[model samples]
Target: MDSIYHTLRKSNPASARILVRKVLEKNNGNVSKTARILGISRATVRRARDGELNDLSRRPKNIRKKMDCFLEKLIAEEAKSTGYRYRLLSYYLKNKYSIECHPPC
Candidate 1:
């Protein structure tokens, strides 16, 4: 329907695609079946279901790397100021940095 298209157009395309996939799954993957239920064309349903969906949820890898570096620097600075136990520092690094300090495995 025009209203459905308008409503979905207001949303992020990736989210709209995900919603279309859910509808298709609920209808057992039958495009015509889903289209009939959704009141949209089979082609539109298929496009929404099989379109090159963008993952807006993921941060860029470089951003993640920068965050890790920043956290590491913060941990080192805090350790210098607090002079906390090595175990505490190691725990902070492990939990926050996701870096393994002890190689048991």
Candidate 2:
């Protein structure tokens, strides 16, 4: 019952085509009923039936921060023992190893 629309993947032409085909079969080749039941536009269902879906590979575009294994393990141990994190963890790292983990900026 949510009105919000969330697009996790921007492009999914191949899946769209497959879905239209299955729904079409279920609805006995009725495009209008298929689109209505699937909550999609009739044009979309028509395009899918017209073989407009392409097989494109979708890949993640997110970047992750790199952390040293030793430093990460040490941080985990310190957090588990003292429950210090973020700014406090930065303070401990700086005071113990003389390295600035998180700058004020």
Candidate 3:
């Protein structure tokens, strides 16, 4: 079976970082849980989360730009809605918008 790292190696590094953050948040910021899910070391996940891992597979800059535009639109819409805090807004952005902003949790 292919390891999770091997599988993710083919994806955009930015997307991978976003995925790692999402997983960590979903698991309540548990490094061990994120590592188990990714089939990597807890240290590796910690490094990536801290932006210390530089071997990221970058996507085309244009693609990233497009994603950022879409995320901005979504955030604006959500921010206008009632009873939405920044933490919840960030969480919604990750889960629903697929945007990788730091949740206020």
Candidate 4:
């Protein structure tokens, strides 16, 4: 028989996952043997067996807001009153309103 690793190398990742599933079945569901035969990790064999071949999302669930709503509103009001741009407005807020102004984290 041809080397099992050769079968995996000849196919793309999707097809390789499918092949891993088939090989796993042929190996009587032995994850270690399946991984050794296919030249892949045991985790990868388990994922393929469980139909989890797709990539997972990397995005974080909770995004941090750049600034607080109250602070933003206060800045907008100050800007309208003084007609000052952001850099100067930051200084104005610091000096006049006693609010520390810096770039949002």
- Each prediction's whole-model lDDT (CA): 0.70, 0.70, 0.74, 0.79
* Per-residue lDDT of model 3, residues 1-105, tens digit only: 766665775775656667788889999999998899888788877877898334745766565434467676767788887457788777877887577787544
Give the TM-scores of the predictions, in the order they appear: 0.44, 0.41, 0.44, 0.49
Give the per-residue lDDT digits (tens) of candidate 1, residues 7-58: 7757776776777788899888989987776677889888887777764457
lDDT of 2 by residue, 67-100 (tens): 6888889878877887986889789878887866
What candidate 2 gets wrong by more than 4 Å, as runs, is 1-11, 55-105
Model 4 over residues 1-105: C-alpha lDDT tens digits? Answer: 545544654665567777888888999999999999777789878877886555557888877756788988999998999998868888999998898877444
Q: Considering every candidate listed, which one attains the maximal TM-score?
A: 4
Error of 4 at 52 (Å): 2.5
Clashes of 4: 0
Error of model 2, residue 103, in angstroms: 56
Regions of model 3 farther than 4 Å from truth = 52-105
Judged by whole-model lDDT over C-alpha atoms, candidate 3 comes out at 0.74
Kindly give the stretch of ten consecutive residues in candidate 2 with the minimal lDDT sum: 1-10
